[model samples]
Target: MLLSSAKLALQDAIEASPLPDDPELQRNLSEYFPAPMRQAYKKQIDNHRLRRDIIATDLANRIVNRLGLIHPYELAEEESVGLAEVASAFVAAERLFDVREIWEELDEAAMPEATRLILFDRAASAMRIQMADVLRISNGFRMPSDVVDELGRGVQKLSTGTEKLLADESLVLTTRLQREFASAGAPEKLAAKVTHLFDLDGAVGLADLAKRTEIDPRKLTNAFTILGQDLGLAWAQGTAALMSPSDVWERLLVAGLARDFQQMRLEFLQRLTRRKGMKDNPCETVNAWLDENAGAIRQFRSMITRARAHTPVAPAMLAQIASQARNVLSR
Candidate 1:
């Protein structure tokens, strides 16, 4: 039986007023020659139970650690979702193994291509499914709606075909942010400022952050933008450092194709804007263009999807994509 199911069964057995009869238990006991032999079996059962409890506790701790690592800002807030509750949900879902697998892959300096892809795909799907419950729990804790929404978007990105890439990028960004804030003297204070500025939808102004950090607004702005750029450069360099030339070229090609598709969409919108005044009904013109280019758009999307699927991204490339996403969201 699955661990989750087994856990439930154990709970039910514990709660029963009169424990159910167990023929297997009796048979095992009968095999023993004397009272001493039966005591040996009891000792074995005690050892097994001790081992099982240790494993369960370790898994729960790992789950809490992973959740906090991924959603540091969210968890750091005064009124944030309970990490214990979120960890329980993962345990209930029997997704602790999935979380374990992801952490194993992440901790490795390098992983085999096939194994990395398989792990990413499986973990991404599991995360996507679990995020709804996490968001629900966050809401119950009265986390800011915008903060919860931001967390949702971050999780959504991490649940896509490019999950490995995004995950690596996130790791890099987190590390750099920590280092950067530490250098500013008040690591926690500066981190909260930066988190509020970018992750919290600029809920705190630049001047306010500057005042709190005792840094000039101009310097803060420069540092923020420069850090963002450095994140991209660091990711690209890291990818090159980790992968073969051909592999790197493949990644570049996939990125180029995605960018081209985005540019195509932009041009279409530009055209719509230019023609808006000439059209009698803007909605009709918009619909007509969409209808006319539907096939082409579908083809472009399909090509990008296929390319992404076939091209495996190095773990080091994750930071750049994550930085790009943050930049987009901030805009």
Candidate 2:
């Protein structure tokens, strides 16, 4: 989806390109254009890419402005070359921290099993990816560059960088860890735990595994501190984009809603979700919750439909979440 902010950026990038004034230069831009962008007007491509670079930088600035120098929001570094790596790194780290806080204030019981499992799984994955990457770099490797920076004075286009995060994911974790685990190295130690936690899929107890692996309980106490707390969560959360195609679109839409709920129904549901009695049976309760957050639901609808030329529905499972959200509001 094109963000409203980026629509203007795209237009401005077109205006700035050298191609518009020179037909021959325009032809070259077309000839050299990558396949994904081949269909775009050559002039448009130059202008868009140029502007997109600026927008990417601007996005960098905006993050800096609000969050300061934090994981996902921070400047691109050698470590961040694998953009997908960082995407999961940031969100997974963030979720780990968030879960820890919630666990402290309440308990793991406060979170839905599915949610916790997903979060824990992501945290483990993020740690594994980062540790492997640090090893990759120290052994001599470099990350690719960000597509561009900032908006308007530029445009900000999104791409997977040069790497495609595949579904089968031939991530050589097994081979890499087999080599790394034989050592007394710290990352390897962590990687071993990552392998277990990830492999066990939330079945491994944080304490039990620490004993079996002959690792420190305190050291194993918090995976976030061992890796990046916020970075891991942010990494997992960001990789929501990389989920199987069947899963992503709606998840993003729901996420878009979760971030913006404002009505009484939503507020009530939010409050209830954060409360103790939140159970698997919250369907009726959720309805009540929705009745409380109707305005927020409307706000969500507005965001999706805001710049739309046509009313869109994907007929996906995500609609279930939206429907559930509305059901809560209606009650």
- Model 1 residue 274 CA deviation in Å: 34
Write candidate 1's Cα lDDT for 101-211 as tens digits.
445534452544554344344343334234323433334422223333333333332223321222244355446645654454433532333322112111122223333
Question: Per-residue lDDT tens digits of candidate 2, residues 23-126?
Answer: 22233345455777777564576676554344333333322222223333121232333333333222232232222242232222344445434434444344
For candidate 2, report its TM-score: 0.21
CA RMSD of each candidate after superposition: 20.8, 21.4
Extract clashing residue pairs from model 1. 165-318, 169-318, 169-319
lDDT at position 244, candidate 2: 32
Question: In model 2, which runs have C-alpha deviations exceeding 4 angstroms?
Answer: 1-242, 246-315
Error of 1 at 175 (Å): 19
Residue 331's lDDT within candidate 1 is 22
